[model samples]
Target: MALASLIMLVPVVLVTSFLSGIFGMAGGLLLLWFLFLVAPASTAIAVHGIIQMVSNGSRAWLSRRYLDLKILAIVSLGLLLAMGCLFAVQYSPNKAIALMVIGLLPLLLWIPASWLTFDASRPSHAFACGLISGALTVMVGSAGPLIDLFFIRTKLDRRVVIATKATIQVVAHFTKVVFYINAALMLDAMGWTTVALCIPAAFLGAWLGKFVLDRMSDLQFRSWTRMIVTCIGFAYFVQGTSAVLSA
Candidate 1:
């Protein structure tokens, strides 16, 4: 990596971590955009996986008491299965498809959870959501919103929701890093030194975010999450549309 790119990574990760920590969303997508600007798609995806793993890990640890183990296990199993499928197929993630999927995932919130046939309370259904989410994460670099959709129906309080989701993401992102590295797709941009410098910044951001989260009411948290997700979706949608138009 160029010296400038490495230098730019710190502030980006710090801000991404704070945003993701506060709302339990959007940080990964922000990092992905920056990585795409500074690196190749594979590098962007791989680095995202690594940084997100650390960021989510910190958040998960901070809120470890509230984690739902059953859901975590079920979703993790699904993520592993999805990883195996990707490995078998030798897939290369499509950038346009990724952008479109990321853009559209938030729209799932507009649909009432009651409209879905499956029970969100069931582990099997959680697994199913995980299957889709895991696959999408590998392609898009951040499917946090999709995971959020699955949890919204469960009606957990804000802290538990954020904690459990962060824990699940730790597993999901780990899978991505392993898969991408094994496939030799992440080789060019695994800058360990750069990553090391960014880790503390990400952790600091998460801490600040948690402080903000503690002060917000459940209603406020949910409202902010939806608004943030919508804005991110529109941004990606525009980027994708522009790419298509130019092509």
Candidate 2:
């Protein structure tokens, strides 16, 4: 990456980070999309995983007071189990179809929360969601919606929701990075330089997002999160459709 290109991405990273800080989910997806536009698929996935690991890590740290350790432990156990299974399975899914599924998933929010019988706060349920999310993230690039599903019905405050989700994603994305070890090797000094430059930008964005988060009522935060997530889903849907049609 040239210095000019790196400079160009600074603002993008800052903006996306701000969004991620505010929503705790959408920014990573959008950033993944941006990286996809500029890098190879394997490289994009690897870099996105790394950057998101940092982004979510910072967010989790910021809201450490609200970290849900129980959920993290349960979900991580399930995630590990799912990852172990992946090592034994040999499969190739249709990438286009997978993206479409990811894109359409957020629409589930339209269903009345009452209609969903699952208890998000339960350990069993959290583990189950993590198991599925771990697998889906390997298939698609990210599983923000699936992660959100695990907390949608919870009565926790917005900041806690963001913080807790951030911790879970840190695990998910770290797994993703290791899974694509070959891709990680593609990061030459320039590539890494770009990533390193973005780290602080990501952190700054999270800090600013904290300011925004502090002002919003929980209801407003939840509403905005759902709306933004739905839009991101549609963006992925369109990108997948275009890719399929072009191919």
Candidate 3:
């Protein structure tokens, strides 16, 4: 079983790296959807966060010269504030909040179409977007789509945008990890092993994504990111409903 489990991770690594290469972010949510049948929801979320934080943090650090510090600061602070608010109800999984966020996720998926434009970098919505991404990411396990929606609207340089988002995501999810660990939602020893196994997949995915970022044009990025975000939202909605039901 252990051998087979390791083998199973092969496809997980491949698919995630491929998608993240073709797109521009972590494929954790997509990988989670594929693995949920074999793992608990919280375990999957924590492992996903841990693996990707290391992976994306490294990607961002190496790609720092391209990052827009001003935009990074704006969004990172909002996510932190959101984390503080999330602290109160962080441990509690009020079906109400999850449901509310889950319900709106679909709606928000379409919002970028109307509210998002290729030429605009809407930082005013950065706080609200980061807030939602921060809150539900820990609670329900996926918030990349929420963050990507506003990002698609922004016209920042692709390297700057992708690397910055990678950095912010790591920071945001790192804080959530502490919350989960404190709330006793973290991984066990074996779970930690599983998470460690996932690390290479995530790192490769981020590296491949940065390579893809170099080749993609702004219009190409906007179009492809929207599609990827839509897929992520759908993945989250399905997995989130399963989490609630399984809980």
lDDT scores in order? 0.81, 0.80, 0.63
Which candidate has the highest lDDT of all? 1
Better of 1 and 3 by lDDT: 1
Tens digits of lDDT, candidate 1, 1-247: 5778888899999999999899887887788877866766666788888888889989999999988888888888898899889879987876766677778888876676568644335888889878988888777777888887887666777888889889888888888888778533434454677888888988999988999999999888887888888888888877766766777
Model 3 alpha-carbon miss at residue 92, Å: 3.2
Q: Candidate 2: lDDT of 16?
A: 84
lDDT ranking, best first: 1, 2, 3
How many pairs collide in each candidate, listed in order? 0, 0, 0
What TM-score should be assigned to candidate 1?
0.92
TM-scores for every predicted model: 0.92, 0.92, 0.78
Output candidate 3 Cα RMSD: 3.8
Model 1 Cα shift for residue 103 (angstroms)? 1.3
lDDT score of residue 10 within candidate 1: 92
RMSD (CA, Å), candidate 2 to true, equals 2.0
Give candidate 2 regions above 4 Å deviation: 1-7, 90-95
Candidates 1 and 3: which is better by TM-score?
1
lDDT of 2 at 5: 61
> Per-residue CA lDDT of candidate 3, range 33-67, in tens?
55444555555555556766766676787588988
lDDT of 2 at 194: 81
Give a tens-digit lDDT track for model 2, residues 5-118.
656676788888888888888898788777766666666777788888888888999999999888888888877777777756843345566557778878876668777745
